[model samples]
Target: MERETLHRYRDIIPDFDAFLQAIRSERITAVRWNPHKVSRARLIEELEECFECVEEVKWYEHAFRLGYEEKPGKTLHHILGHYYIQEESAMVAALVLNPRKHAVVLDMCAAPGGKTTQLSALMENTGTIIANDKAIPRLKSLVANVSRLACLNVSITWNDATKIQAKECFDYVLVDAPCTAEGNLQERITLMPRRMRESLSRLQRNLLAKACELVKPKGIVVYCTCTFAPEENERVVSSILERYNVKLEPLKLKVPHAKGIESFGREQYGCEMRKTARIYPHHLNSGGAYIAKLKKRG
Candidate 1:
């Protein structure tokens, strides 16, 4: 945990050990992302310095390059498909989901195509990816992004994840299920609806069940969320473990210049928690997020 974050949370949990212990217990609390240095200009500056993907200038400007010279977000994302403008936290889910190049995968709630597109990149444009979303309009966006990225292996579906029950159809499944957006309150302030708190848990339960059903036996199923609620995070995960024949896969998340997030969920929640990773804002210089890797057991 970051010092600032610990300071903000010291009243509730005294030290890093205590904070983690609490998380292991599944006591609902807010997590802080570190460095907190996600300015639009900073992201652009970093992207520009990297020469590997020069074609991404258009994506840089359109998707999220807030520091465009003029007319930011006009048609640049469409023109180049240089990269997908996605939430920094959201990317963690895909990386941790750890798709192999030849693995058949399913992204249950792929829309605006962030994770779907990233999977394409991870697979180096190989294998089959079935990206499904509930909204027809969003599916179109996913299609456009996939097409623009020149990924021929991806297929888009506009249907609720709950209804799709292809048994053992994929080597892996990513359920970046929708949540209350509590972890994003600091960034996406548009989460102004209070009524959603009551309904979000139920929705998550529905999504988790469906995701577990679609995953193949002995395959990996990753459950991720951008919220900090236990009902949505640890509780949903535990419920799945209890209700289904699945086990948690602890993720030692790795990225360039990225530190690993610790698992406090094991002891705190009265369940096997190490199989999943929980990230908070104070853990690193990014947004608050909770990620758990669950694999179907024999």
Candidate 2:
């Protein structure tokens, strides 16, 4: 683990010691019920008989927190695609997008399809979701999961999202851009090299810019990352705000989190940075995420 890299945010991250400890502790297991397949009550009742604990996540009714030892993948419910085992915090971006039924949406970097499936459930399989991913290897899981979850609305596409030319077509766009994965400290934290950091930062911005272009007038775009790096989160957002005609909106989540720092080191992101949300592991006893919601001008 690169403590030095993460320690740089000590001043911004609340309860720094607790944040560090929380990341080091075991990650909680969480699953979202597939409303398209099974009723929540029935799933909960069945899950209770197998796992020693089945506590629901307060903010999200469809999700539940299980004990550390609960291997949800090994259960029949998972096999039947009645539920999906996802990192609790990963569920937020989809809900934040909150797409309407029959709307056209895009998951810019959708792979391993957690958020895509969730969005399908939220839309109740009524909309068109172009779940695009660049890598072929990752698409295998993306295809499988979408199929397993019976997401009839999702259509898989292989493309470099930065080059996607579907301009002003989608009602909503989600840029769950790939990042350093610093938030998954429970597994391991890889030291990000300067070259890699610069590369990823550029990629994140390009992907976001493409999302802005792809969304219709007055549409919504949600940019999310599992890393805490400002270069990838707020900095990328700030750059987009400067170049695009979009407005930042405050995230109203029911979970514990800190507002995005307006200024990190010498860079100033302005007051709008406060509208973004940063979820640390300590906040949900799960993984961490940085989420920003933007609405395009009509």
TM-scores for the candidates:
0.70, 0.97
lDDT (10s digit) by residue, model 1, range 15-130:
44633443333222211111112334544554556422322222112233223123222334325554444544566787777788888999999887877887777787778999
Global Cα lDDT for candidate 1:
0.62
Local distance difference test, per candidate? 0.62, 0.91
The local lDDT score (0 to 100) that residue 154 gets in candidate 2 is 98
User: Which is the leading candidate under TM-score?
Assistant: 2
Cα deviation at 129, candidate 2, in Å, is: 0.7
Compose the digit string of candidate 2's lDDT tens values, residues 75-192. Answer: 8778889899999989999999999999999999999999999999999999799999999999999999999999999999999999986679999999999998888866354457
Residue 44 Cα positional deviation in candidate 2, in Å, after optimal superposition: 1.0
lDDT of 2 at 159: 98
Please report the TM-score between candidate 2 and the true structure. 0.97
